[model samples]
Structure formats: C-alpha cells, structure tokens
Target: MLSFTPYENPTYFGILAIALLPIVIGLLCKKRFHWYETIISIFFLVLTFGGPKLTQGYALIAYLIYEVVLVWLYTSYRKHKNQTSIFVGAVILAIIPLVIVKLTPAIQNGQQSLIGFLGISYLTFKAVQTIMESRDGVLKAFNPWFFLQFLVFFPTISSGPIDRYRRFKKDYDHVPDTDKYLQLLQKGVHNIFMGFVYKYMLAYLFGTLLLPKLQQQALSAHGLSWSLVGVMYVYSMYLFFDFAGYSLFAVGTSYFMGIETPINFNAPFKSHNIKEFWNRWHMTLSFWFRDYIYMRLVFFFMKHKVFKSPKTTANITYIINMTIMGFWHGVTWYYVTYGILHGIALVVNDWWLRYKKKHQKQIPHNKFTEIFAVFVTFNFVCFTFLLFSGFLNTMLLAK
Candidate 1:
C-alpha cells in the first residue's frame, strides 16, 4: 500500500498513463467502458488516500457519503417543495465540514482536523453548488451516481477547474465524434506535456530552486529590500506555474476520458486589471464565485433595495464574495487580507473603467497604456501574492 498526492511526481503520471490507456482506446473506438472507468478511479483514489493516509481515506469516504446523501435528500425535497430556509440549511450543512476543516487549524493552533482531507474544499464547492442549482430548478434531474463520479472525478478532484454538474453530465452522457475525439487526444497530450514544464520544470526552478533562497534572503533582511522584491516575483511565478500546471494535468486527463473539463487558467499574468486577472486566472473557481455568490448577492441586494445604486451593490458584493473566497483559502490573516485587497482592487478597477469610459475622448487608449496597465496589474498581483505567501507574517514576527 502506498499513497501519493495527485500529480506529485513522475511515478504517479506513469501509473496514470497506464490507467488512461484503456479510456483513450475506448474513446477512440466509440465505446465507453464506464465500469472500467469507475474501477480505475477507485484505484487512483486508493493510491492517493490509502496506506499511511488511510485516515484521510476514511474521512473522504464518510464525507462523500454524507454529501451524496445530502444532495440526494435535497434533490428529493426540491422536486416538490422549494423552501428558502431548507435550501439555506442544506447549503450550510454541505459546507460545515469544510468550515470545520478551515477553522480547526486556526482554533487549535494549527492542528489539522480529523475529518479533513485533501480536496475537501473542492468537494464542498461541488456539493453546495449542486444544492444551489437544485434550489434554482436548474439541476432538475439529479443522478446520485453520476454526481458522485463528478465529485470524485479523480483528475480534477483535489484541485479543480470546478466543472458544473450540468456541464459534466452533458460530457459524461455523450461520446464525441471521431475527429473531435482525435483533437481532444492531441490537446490532451499537449496539455500533459505543458503541465510537465509548468509543474516540474519551471515551478521547480522558481519554487524549489529559487523561492527558498529568496525567502531566506528576504527574511534575513529584517525589512523590505531587493531580496523581498525577488521573493515577490519568484513566488508569483511559482504560484502561477504550480497551480496552472496542476490545472493542465487535471484538464488534460479529463480530455483523455472524453470529458472536456474546463480549463483553470489562461495567460493570467497578461491581465490588464484585477477583474481581468481573476477572469483569466482560476477561471472556473472565479466563475463559480461570480455565478453562485456575487451574482446572487447582487441580485438579492438590488431586489431588496439593500443599496441605492446598482454599482454600489456590485461593489459591496465584490468585497463580500472575494473575502469569502479568501477565507476559503485559509483562516490566516494573510489569506483574508489577500482576498480583501483583491476586492478593493476590483472596486477601484471598476470605478476607473467607468470613469475612463465617460472621459473616453480625453483618455488616451493606446498600446503603451495597455502595456502599462499590464505592468501595474502584474506588479500589484505579485505584491498581493507576497501577502498570500505569509512571508510578511514571518517578517512581522522577526521584528
């Protein structure tokens, strides 16, 4: 019995390749061996959570059972009755495990919760959204088995491009045409190879090789210095590559199974503003927040006259939504600050956009401005990543 993190090393990918071969072949031949797919998925789950990580395995199992049944019950109830209180209760219950997991570390001086396991947050996201959609009458026909598959879709299970229930079901229920399947295969191979460069090569170069040195240098500086700047830039690169690389692997693996999982990142560093950065980076998660949280909050605010102006409503929701996202990352002060700053950036960016649009005749819209915008956004993001990294906390402690 052995345990491994998803996409952690060469050996895991090797096993993955062997396992995916059957799926690739089946898709090529216009066949889907779902039974086989389930078996391999379970096998990979074991490799990830079994052996020394068996406690996590148990937690995952119990968590899945609770969520699946909870969704089932909600779907059952939603079919006939739609009570807002019930829906809210269900959503809260779905997130309770994740909340406890997050709070345990902060409350208990960094002791991990017994019920916590890798990807709990992601799983909770899936479950809560399912409930939300169910309440909205969007996800009418809820298949418990398929829902379970989507939640445990081992490829994007741990960290996600956060596929929706309806979207996933559409892909799962259909077989792509020959040409499309071939294209998917080609892209899948390309994505996996690209992931190797991102996660293994460049991330290693930045995070493993460069980040530690920069971190040590920055820490010893006892104050802001060039070393801190180096740490900021190197860490920003490392964070992007590490996550973008994982996203590539998850999406590429999904492609092999003919599932067409949504991508998580674009050229995020090229974004000209914080809003655009979010749209380009972690596309799925941000979109989820937009659809499920921000949009809903805005609608509620507007509906109930919570704010006099629609713009004000949006600005307030942006802060609330992103702050929750930050807390979702962790309970630490740095994480919360990271979210709050992004929220403020979004508000400011929106204001600037509105002002620029009104003064379009006076405002110079040119190539240079675009480039300058990119520079500003990238550097601002890097500085925020410095906060997100918790190195500033270390600096404060050193002081």
Candidate 2:
C-alpha cells in the first residue's frame, strides 16, 4: 500500500530534486515557470515514485487515455454545436468504471488492493468535475496539455482541494511574477517540512505506538468503551494531519507554478459546529457538493415534494445530500454510518441555527461556550472517523 509517509523514500526525494531543476533553470534563463511547466515536472516526480503497482499503473494509463478522449470530445463539441449533449453523455458514461471500482469491494481487498491504485477516488472526482464544467460552459477554452496537467497534477492528485475548472483557467492564464515565485518557493519549503512533521512525527507516533497499544488493550480487556474513544481522538488528528499536509504540499506546488489553487483546510478542528467544520475543512470538496450536488438535490426534492412543504423539507434534502456526499468518501458500512451520523449532526445544527435566530437572547456566546462547542464538534468528527477506521471491523465481525 502506498503510505502517506513523508520523505523516507530516496526515490521521492530524487524526483523532487528533478522537478526543482526546471524551476532553477527557468529562473536562470529569466523565464518564469508557467503552471503547465510545473505540472509536467510534478508528473515526472510522481511517476518516478509510482514504481510498480499494476492496478495503479493501469489506472493511470486509463486516465491518460480518458483525458485524450475527453479533450477530443470537448474539441468536437466546440467545432460542432449539435454534439454538445452527446459530449455530456460521453463524459457521464466515462465515469461508470470508476463508480463500479469504488462501489465494489472485492477489487480493493487481499492482494487486489495492493495493485488497486492510490487516490483513484480523488482523480475520478477531478476528471468528472472538469468534464461536467466543460459541458456546462464554465471552461471557455480547452488546451489538451493543460487539461492533462490538471487531470494528473501530482501533489493534489492523491488528495485534492478539488480545483474548479473556471478558477484553474483563470490561474493558468496568468504567468508567475519573480517575487511571487520566491514567495511560493519559500512556502513550498515550509509546507514540505510541515508535511514531514505531520506525517512522520504526529501521525506516526499515534499510528505506530498509541493506536496499536490502545487496540491491544481494548482487545485484551474484552471492552472498547475507553479505548474506542481514545482511538477516535488519535485517528481524527492523524487524518487531519495526513490530509492537510498533502493539501499544503499541493497548494504550495501550485503556487510555485503560479497557479493559485484554493485552500482545502482552514483549521477545521476549531470549527464551532458541523456546518462550520464542513465549510472550513475540505473547503473545495464541500463547495463541489454544495454547488453541483446539494443545492440541485434540494431544489429537485422541493419541486417534487408530496406537499408544498416548509423550509424543513428543503433542509432535510440538504441533510440527505450531505449524507450521500459522506457515503461517496468510501465503500463500507462504516462509511454509511459516518454519513448518516454527520447528516444527523447537520440537521440538529440547522435546528439550532433556526432556534437561535428566533430567540436571540437564549444561546450562550461566551468564550468557554465557544470553546465547548468547538470541542464537541471536533470530537463528533473524530468518533465518525474511528467508526470508519478498519479497526472497528474486528469487533463487528466477532459479534
């Protein structure tokens, strides 16, 4: 399995060095590195690290072919207006395999998962979103190379901020200024270090030591009350660090290339409510669901309601949409549970919001109260992650 291990692999370091050479050369030649140039270098770096995973390799090849076909489809649509819906249909058809592979578990187990590829989910979403946007007239121009660059952009590919097509277009159109390049280089260096600290130090400590110890003790005691709670805390923190670290690297790299991809995380643990957490954490993905998935589902459900229901009906639809979004994160019963749990939390949060709006004098607004809300929200998120973690499988199966 490909790990989120930082810098322990010499091959990765070498690849990073190789990617940097272009930037150095670009600077020396007085040619500011374009976003596409940085993208190419990053692709080389990731390909070098990819080494030899059969399914992953095949998936990448498949993705490359898919990108070409998508570009052709886009071009054909632009050339002949009559074929626009055909292009949309083709893009939807393209996502079938990804959906199947993700929803089917047999392919991700035993020796199969070893070759099953890392970040297929992330890549699939990026491709689908891009195609959907292109069909919606969000992307006015299409460059095959640029499309491929966005499709397989290395740093964010594994775990993404889920860059939007319009934003990407705008960023790519602008070239990097020299001073800005220096700033990005500084930020990239800092992010690389922080990624190491998060993955190697914090996550490693918990994953290798604290978690294992707790799991063993929990099993030995034949009870999981306390251990499960501790495991939840540790795993949640690990997830935040692991994913946030990757996002930082991605944004920093894009910055170096003069493409300012939107930020993914914003100290999500500090969020005072489930809605706030969703807003701050995985900001891009949340917006993706909000724009592409949630609001549409809400409107559709509202339009087709059994009665002319109140705002509550619309809110229920939002919860259902978010539940589905959570389910999209993985293909397991635990993921389903996680989704449902989050949906409930969001519903309750909405209720609270409405209550506070109606009775402004009721809710506490003290620092301690704010801190408590943040604490509760953070733990709620943590517990869901614990349930989703593979450790819960042993207990469930034993029953």
Candidate 3:
C-alpha cells in the first residue's frame, strides 16, 4: 500500500489532479456528486494515514468519534442549559487529547504519543470553536454526520487554514453556479501553480539544500557568527515559502471543492509592524487566537476589573495569549520564549502607534519611513524566527 503526505511533491499533485477531475466536472455542470466526493475523501485519507502510518489512521478515527460525540452532547446541553463551568469543562475535554499529544514528547524523552494524529491541533480548534459558538447560540444545530464531514474535510485536514463549521456547511450543502465555479477553478489552478513555485522550487532550494549547509556552518562555528546570521535569514524565507505554499495548496484544494476556505497568508513579509505581520501571517490561526483566546481574556479581565487600566490589561493578555500559543507549538523553552517575544513586540508596536498618533505633526510619515518600517519589521521577525528555530538550543545546550 502506497502512502503519501498531502502535497508532499509534484507526483502527489498529479494524483490529486486525477482524483479531483470528476468533482470538477460535476461542479462545472452545476451539480455536486456527493458520493464521488466521499469516495475521494476516503481514498486520500487512507493515503495519508495508511501503510506505515496506520496507527495514526486508527487514532484519527477514534479521535473523530470522540469529538463528534463530545460536541453532540455539549450542543444538546447548551440548548437547555448554559453554564460557564460546564462549557469550560466541555472545551477542556475536547482539548485533553491535544494537550496530551503536546506534552508526551517533553515528558517521555521526545517520544510521540500513540494517540497523536496529523492535524489534531487544527481539528481540536474547530471542535472547541463550535462548542463555544453553540453555547453562544450562533451554531443552533449539530448534525453528527455533517460534523464528521467538516472535521474530515481532506483539503485542510492535515494542516488547516481552519474553516468554521457554518461557513463550511454553507459551501458543502450548495453547488456553485457555472460561472462561479469557473472562477474558482481559475483561482484554484493559479494557487496550485504558485504553491508549486513556493514549495517545490524555492522551499526545496532553501530548506532542503541551503538550510542544511547553513546549519552545518553555523553549528561548526559553535557561537554567534555571520554563518548563524545567514542561517537566520535563510531559514525565515524557507519557513515562509514552505508554509505559505502549503497553505495555498490547502485553500486551492478547498476552492476546487467549492468551499471558500480562508487564505492563510497575505504578503506577511511585507507587513509594516509586528501587529500587521500577525494580521497577514498564518492569518486564520492568528485570527483564531485573537478571537478565541486574546479577546476572551481581555473581556474577562475587564468584566472582573482585573486591571486598573485597559492598556495594562491588553499588554498582559498579549503576553499570556502568545505564551499559550507558543506552548501549543510545543512544550519547550524556545517556543515559549518565541511567544513572549512576539507578545512584547505587539505591546511595543501598539505603544509606538499611539505615540505616533499623538505626535503626528512632529513625526514624519512618508515613503522612506514606510520602507524603513517594513525593513525593520521584516528583520525583527526574522530574528524571532531564529529563536523559534531551536538551532540556538542545539548550539548552546548540546555538550
């Protein structure tokens, strides 16, 4: 049994193209062939989790059933009773598996959890969001089968741009008109080709070829040097292209399926500040953190008068929210530090903007200033990515 990770290479896209053909034809004719979609989804799911990864396949199935039932019960409870503790407990239960998966490596000398599966974090995000929205009365219905379909939506299944249940259901239940689908097809093809450039060509050059060599040189130096600086910048670009490329493929595939899944990257490097960078980079995830964690924390703080001032409240929330995000990446000092740095950067960015607004006459805003801001933001982000890369851990900690 041959297995492939989603969008791992050109050959994978070739297989995907063939698989997607019938769905394309059906949509072009203003019809949705639901059975055909199901067949291909299962096929790709198997390809992703079968063969050497069969354990993960079983884990995914078990996790899916668990989440489905959890959400169903929560929704049922929410329809009659809305209690904060119950809602919190439900969210915690939904995340327990993901938390274990994250902690297993740290506690077990870097061994992966047996129950961990690809995209578990992403799936948990969707599940928890659904429960929250349902509690708030936004999501009124919970169809187990539809919920399963949304969770297993193969395009963004492995790593997501994280589609919402309501939005996904709208697209899943309707077929686009001919003209609209043609537009989707055009955008889809463009995205896939651009993804080809970003991932296959540029990422391969930077990540597979140059990153190793730079790592070798940087490691040999065993301290701060130009080689390490080279690694920082190169790794930043490689990370951007590689991830943005994968996001493009995910969104593109979603488009092909007539679902307008949100785009994850939007010229993030061109951002003028750390806040703007967050707005552009991995936008879905950032927005998720902003909405579900940061905003909620701020609201809770204000509601309870936890802080004397709004500024202090926001600053503290920024740190905590980002640190949690960092921990979500992994239970490591480096990841936590990365989050803390970004949190500080965001606070500083906010302060600078406020200062500029008050001193608008004294502070000159022009093309030169704009360019300088972009340059500074880009380099600052690259530096943070260096910390996030864990190469420093290898260099300083390894005996």
Candidate 4:
C-alpha cells in the first residue's frame, strides 16, 4: 500500500472519499457504525504508516501500546488510591518518551531518535492530560480501548487541533441527528474546499513561489533591509495559510465523521495583542497550554506562596509557560527564544491592559487605535516567526 500524509495531495483525499463514503451515508441514516469506522481508521492509518513510511507505522504501534498500557495501569491505580507523588510520576512517565525524542536531535548532532515518530508530541500532550485529569478525579472511567481510539484519531493525528478525552468520547459515543449530520456535511465540504484554496492556491503562491525568492534576496542583502522585511511578512503569511489550511482539513474531516474537532486558527493575524493572538492562533494548543501548563503553574505558585504579589507570580509563570511552549517546538535556541519573546510580549500586554484599565480616560480607544494594535501585533508576531523559521541562523552562518 502507498503511504499518504493527511491532506498532502488531492489523490489522498480521493482515497479518503472512498473510505469515508459509507460512514457518511451511515451517519445520514442516523446509524453509527463503530466497526466500519474502525476499519476505515485502520485503512487510513496504513495508508499513512504503510509502504515507505513503515518505520513510523511501527513506531506508532509501539507508542500506542505503551501509552494504552500506561494509562490503563494509572487509571487502575488511581481508582484505588490518591497520591501526589505517584500521580506526578505517572505524568512524568507519560512524557519521558516525548522528552527523549525531543532531546535526541539536540544531543546527537541533529540525528533523530528511534522512538520518534510523526504526531508524537500531540500524542504525548493527550496522554499527559489524561493522566492529569485522572489525578484530579475528573476522568473516572478510563476505557483503554476508547482512549486508544481518541489518541490515534487519524484526522487530527498528524498535526492537531487536539481534542480532550471526555469531549471526544461524548461525540464518539453517539450519532448526530439527520439535520445536524446534513449541516456537518455542508460544513465539511466547505472547509475542505476552503482548505484546498489555502493549502494549494494561497500557500503555493506564498510558500512555494514567493518565499524562496524573498529568502534569497534577504540573504543576499547580508543583513536587515527591505528584502528582509518582505521575507518576514511573506513567511508569516505563508506560515499561517499553510498551517491554517492543514487545520481546516483536520477539523473538516472530523466534522464529516460526526466529531466536532476544535479549530486551530481563527484569523490570528487580526488579533489586537499577543494575548488575543494566542486565543486565536493554534487555539487548541494554546488553550491546552493555558489550561494545563499556564494555569497549573499559576495555581502552584499561589498555593506555595512562591511570590507575595499576584502580578509577580503571573509574570514569572508567563515566561515559564511560553518558554516551555518554545522548547516544545524544538530544543534549538531560536525556538526557545521565540517562546521567550512571546512570553515577554504577553507580560507587557497584560501590564498595558491593566494600566489602561486604571487610566481609561487617558488612553484613547478608537478605530485608529484598534487598527494600530492589530498592526503592531501582526508585525511582532511576524518578527518572531522570522526567528522561528531559522532563516536568521542560516543568514548568520552565511555572513
């Protein structure tokens, strides 16, 4: 069988059409076919992990087994007792594979780790959250079989608008009514078409065509110039269209399958500030970090009295949270720096908002101000994407 990356080409969607046709018809009739859904899932998984990509297939299988068993054991243990250290240990164990996978290239001169595979980071995030929720006594019944399905849900498997366990379970356990299913059909088709425009037409123009010429010009300039500015904006546009396009495909496919996968992008470039941008961009991931990482850190600091001032506690957590997010991109300096910069931006944005609240009469809010905020946020995000793109590192080496 030939392997296909999800949404990589029109041909893959063709095959997906054949596979999903039955599920679509079934849902139309208000009947859910779990077994057939399983079969199609396997079909797509093989189409993704089979053929030349067999190594990733093997890695996925092994990783799933490990996660399934670990979650099972943890859930079993959790039901019997509650202990902080054990829960923490379970969470750590859940993430160790991801940690090793991330660190391998850093230490091995850019060589990949054997345990690494596509979607590993997303899977780790899902697993850790499962363990965390279980610890909080919220996720009482952890069905290993269903949990496995949730983790490997192929639509969002590769890159995600990561859905939570209970949320997915709620959808997976039922078939939408005929009216709702028809609506989903309409949305699914619209999103996929829109994604075609974004990924193929728009992204092809910006990323495949425009970006390379801009990059070459910027590099030739040997430092900052209008060429560099052009590169920044072009790359930023390319990045958003490409990723948002991918997210559309994932979410649209999930809709067809009667699962309402959360969206990743929502006009992030129009955001008025870093905080607003985070709420708009890669929203599922941002919300996950906010809920799991940022909020947890804030609560921990407050509980421990780590800082006397709430503002200080929040400021410190913002840095740590964003830094971790950056490092999650990769162990590289640029990625880490990108995270730190965003963290700083968030802190400053928060402070400014609070100050504005205290001095509402002094700071004018208007249409022009709104436009200015969007422009500033857009440029700042684009600058960070420049660092994120690693083009600067290449340019520095060339210099």
* Backbone atom clashes (below 3 Å) for every candidate: 0, 0, 0, 0
After superposition, candidate 1 runs with Cα above 4 Å error: none
Give one digit per residue, the lDDT tens place, for model 2 in 1-399: 342222446566566667767765575454656664756655653463454544466766676677567655765575447365676676666666566665666454622333235656666676667666666666667677777767666656666768866677666666566776677678777776787787777878877778888877666666667887787788787788777777776777666565677888888998999999999988988888787677766766777783476567766766687677766766667877888888788889988888988897877678998899998998888878888786687766755
Off by over 4 Å in 3: none
- What are the per-model C-alpha RMSD values against the true structure? 0.8, 3.5, 1.0, 0.8
Model 2 residue runs over 4 Å out of place are 1-11, 24-50, 78-88, 106-116, 302-307
Instruction: Please rank every candidate by lDDT, starting with the best.
Output: 1, 3, 4, 2
Write down the TM-score of every candidate.
0.99, 0.86, 0.98, 0.99
Model 1: per-residue Cα lDDT over 162-269, one tens digit each: 999999989988889999999999999999999999999999999999999988888888998999999999999999999999999999999999999999999999
Query: Any residue pairs clashing in model 3, and if so which?
Result: none
The deviation in Å at residue 360 for candidate 4 is 0.5
Model 1, C-alpha of 26: deviation from truth (Å): 1.1
Number of clashes found in candidate 2:
0
Ranked by TM-score, the better of candidates 2 and 3 is 3
Q: Which segments of model 4 are wrong by more than 4 Å?
A: none
The top-ranked prediction according to lDDT is 1
Give a tens-digit lDDT track for model 4, residues 81-183. Answer: 9998998889889999999999999999999998888899999999999998998899999999999889989999899989999999999998999999889
